[model samples]
Target: MPYVFVGSVIVGPLLGEDAVFGSLTAQLAAFAVGLPLAAITALFPLTRPMSVAAVRALCDVPGESLADGPARSRTARGRTVTWFTLHLGFGGIISGMSLALPPFAGVLIALPFAAALRGSRVGMPEVFGEGWLLALSPVIGFASLVALAGCAAGAGTLLARWAPELLGPTPADRLAAAEQRAADLAVRNRLARELHDSVGHALSAVTLQASAARRVLDKDPEFVREALTAIEETTRRTVGELDAVLGVLREGDQTAPTAPAPTLAADLDGLLKRTRAGGLRVRSAVELGPQGPDALPPMVSREAYRIVQESLSNALRHAGPDATAALRIALDGTDLEILAQNPLPATGAASRRGGGHGLRGITDRARLLGGTAEAGPVDGTWRLRVRLPLKGPHDHDHDPKKPQKPQKPQKPKESA
Candidate 1:
């Protein structure tokens, strides 16, 4: 590797007085040449990855990740250039000694045998032509080789220590990377919850609807027609929900208006009717402003709809056949209250039907909207109570009335 730099010959002339000055001058010239070469090479994006690889391999650095990616930011780009300068400058000096010292030591050792081998004093230096000095020449050469070994080892240690400090990603880059991961994970979790809720509710309703239709197949055609119609509507709704979930996966296409979200104003009546058709007797009371459920924040309306939907699905699942549930939705002062109650089943269906992934889904929707939900046995009834603020944490972001300052109306420009 010493000859790899091709600059060690600068030290090849260090023996004579004239060679001493010339060697020092050439060594300085090598360092000078390295400075500009490092700066120029660092401008290319590929240079950072290459430098990281060289440091990891040649410097004996340990770790799978030396640096995250190629340098892009100004600070990282500048660091890449500085590391290149150190490599070219110090590497040239160290490699030169590595090649020159070991060989020079060999020449000195051969000095004692020069006359015997050549039949003359042909290759022997005049200063050590005879006496103990000639014998000690090999000792001096051995000492020089040992010193070179330590110097090279020390240089390598320093490079390994500096590798991460000079080449790893900066704090700002790491922060941005973590934030990106968090946002992507949030989208995935939300989609998973949506898929779970929609599919579960549909299956429960369809099963009951089909069972009811079979019982009345030869009896009342009117009741069978109604049950089949309910099944058709339930499947259609489930397909729309699936499409919306798929659209979000396509690219977070939440604003694509082709499939609107099911809110209380738009979908609650249908939900209750379908659940009743499934054989659960639901006693309902909904009190809303003249503006109806839409008067509240869109998130509040949407989440409320889901909380009730999941509650009914849980009832169909845990309340056994023909189980009756109490449903109530009303605005209580500054908060919106939704309470659902059903008697615990005699059979150990869920150990407690009120608690499961469905219950968790209800609570998650409530908490995400800056609300609270509780479910458990109370007076022999498994009751779920949820309280949500009219203008909650999520409302600020989705509030339709939240005003935005008018743009100066310049030509279209890219936003960060």
Candidate 2:
């Protein structure tokens, strides 16, 4: 292989000088031709050692043949040491041969074996007599070097001539790698969105309920009890949800059964009732907005409830215990308007700057319903205003009776 590789290098320069390909092109030309030739021969795979010892033996053939082969009866560790010694003697001979001939030839023989055995132990067998090996090993090692050089040179030449294309990176491998990266990025994005929605809602609820419970402790024990209950329930629910989410990542529980998801239907009414109980003086004026024929959509109700719930919760937390929280909902043309507000406290925490997921989540929910939400401090009070399009959960068209008239009806023509 070494001779063949050197021969190609020399031949390339000569061919270029002959003007087969101009002088400037020869640099690229050598690699282009050598690559295809290397592929066709499949020379490297066949000649390479399966283990460190095999590589060393091939490189230092003469030394390996003369040295004592490892006793097949030896223990694995003993045999490994014996094998290593044989290779070291082989490598030394190859290195010496390089000084006698061209340095590249020695490199072509010894370097591959060294790299293959990089992590392996390189020691001689202590059990064997050293004098016996030391004497004949050098002579055998020199002969092995010459044989390996001759073989490497022939194989490398044949590969370079016939299968150069196989030597380079393939298009298929690159495509597979790119596809894996894309899939990883997609999974990360989904996890981020789920965490944002779950943790944001739970934390906001916990904070609001805790603050309210503290204020009502002395004045209204019953109300305080209710708020405390809400806190416990919310905490327990959050933990269960988190466990289920994390369970998917655990290897030990590969077959672990997931806890059933909590249903909103059973808890929503209790959720709403408790907030009103928590010193908010909440007034519920919610009425189902008109739907074309279909019933109210589950998402619409869920989002609407969240919007009102979060706003009132914030009102209780920041607007003071004595503050009056009012919630109103009514239909305005094709939209449902939800407005929640509380009086500014005489001395209390400043208005919360943004709607918690109660606000943001509601807004995102509204957007999903083709609606919108606005929340901010308004005229000595905090206001949450939302406009939800009045399309029932299943309705995709307007009600037939409620014809959309562009102009008022003209006077009847019966008299004419």
Candidate 3:
């Protein structure tokens, strides 16, 4: 239809009244001039989306076959132009056949009956025809109409087959979509880690505290009340961190709570007390520089707090009841060192070595910050050590996870 409208303006002036019956060569020449003029319009960005929609509907193409977005690249635009040109050419041919062929066929079918109705012999269509051969004219006309119908159906099939190849996502579009999927997966994974560390640690503490209070409730009213108090604090803090973790999902919403994530600067003291509530004896020495934990980068601090929490959670779970664990956090040069060690519980020697998903999450967290995590039984005790750079993961010339020599805790360096 577009070509028909445009061609009238282009071929109409050239042929004047002969537009319908122009000489073959003259018609071809006019079409040649008008074809490029029509095709050039397809290069516009809007044309790709419009043609994609039209092809899908009119050709009955599957929704997945054509891309929904507009032409965004040279390759996509080139394919769109080719498709649009084919659309115009085939539409013009089918339309012309629909208007002219059926009536012409009908007249030929009626020609034989004309003489019979008039009761007088009449001359047939000639290159000098008059007898049984005249009967062949109607048959030929009917066949011509059938051929036109077949051509139209075949053209529809051709367009449907080509629509997917021309209109589907380009390589660039596919790549962009893939990157978006990866980023979404990364965010979901980080949330999972945070939820696990926060809730798991809290649950372990509450369970231990409840059991201790239950056993001593008759003879030790004071201890039971303290246990209940710890349980309340742990649940309340866990719920707050849980909400912060879940906020990642509602990030773009106006109604989302703006709770800050857990970090060492704010949560380390509470974490130590929570570990003690879980029936693990914790002896700790944390010496950050004079600038204190608040001087660390937010990402480093947040991930560091989780790493410590998970390590302690592992100790609480696998180091058995009432085992003393040593926790040392110190700033050593440009690196922050976290070392957690405890005697392997008499019954948990093998189990302590296999800390499962919690240990794996800790390792991933440290690696994400370009740090290293090493946890295993050292001598007769289990040890978990991690090293993270204060400047985050991007500053180092070498891999932060690379194995380095074990160093004893030293006096913290003052921040400059």
Candidate number achieving the greatest lDDT relative to the actual structure? 3
Tens digit of per-residue lDDT, candidate 3, span 1-416: 55444655667676664553345454455556656876898888888789888987788988776776778889988988898888878876787689778876776677666555223344234631565756776897799899998999999999889988988888887887789889999898888888889998899889889999999999999999999999999999988998888888888897877578889999888898878877888888777765567766678888889999988887887788768888888887888899988788787554455467888888888898888898888887889899998775544433567564544444743221
State the lDDT of candidate 2 residue by residue for 22-58, as single tens digits: 4435534543454445333322332122333443334
lDDT of 1: 0.76
Q: What is the overall TM-score of model 1 with all chains considered together?
A: 0.69
lDDT of 2: 0.52
lDDT tens digits by residue: candidate 1, 49-134 = 88888877787776444666788788888887887777766777787788778877887787777756323444445677656888
TM-score of each: 0.69, 0.42, 0.80
Looking at model 3, report the run of 10 residues with the lowest lDDT sum: 116-125
* Total residue pair clashes for candidate 3: 0
After superposition, which runs of candidate 2 have C-alpha atoms over 4 Å from their true positions? 1-266, 289-294, 329-336, 347-358, 390-416
**Best-fitting candidate, scored by TM-score:** 3
Error of 1 at 391 (Å): 1.3
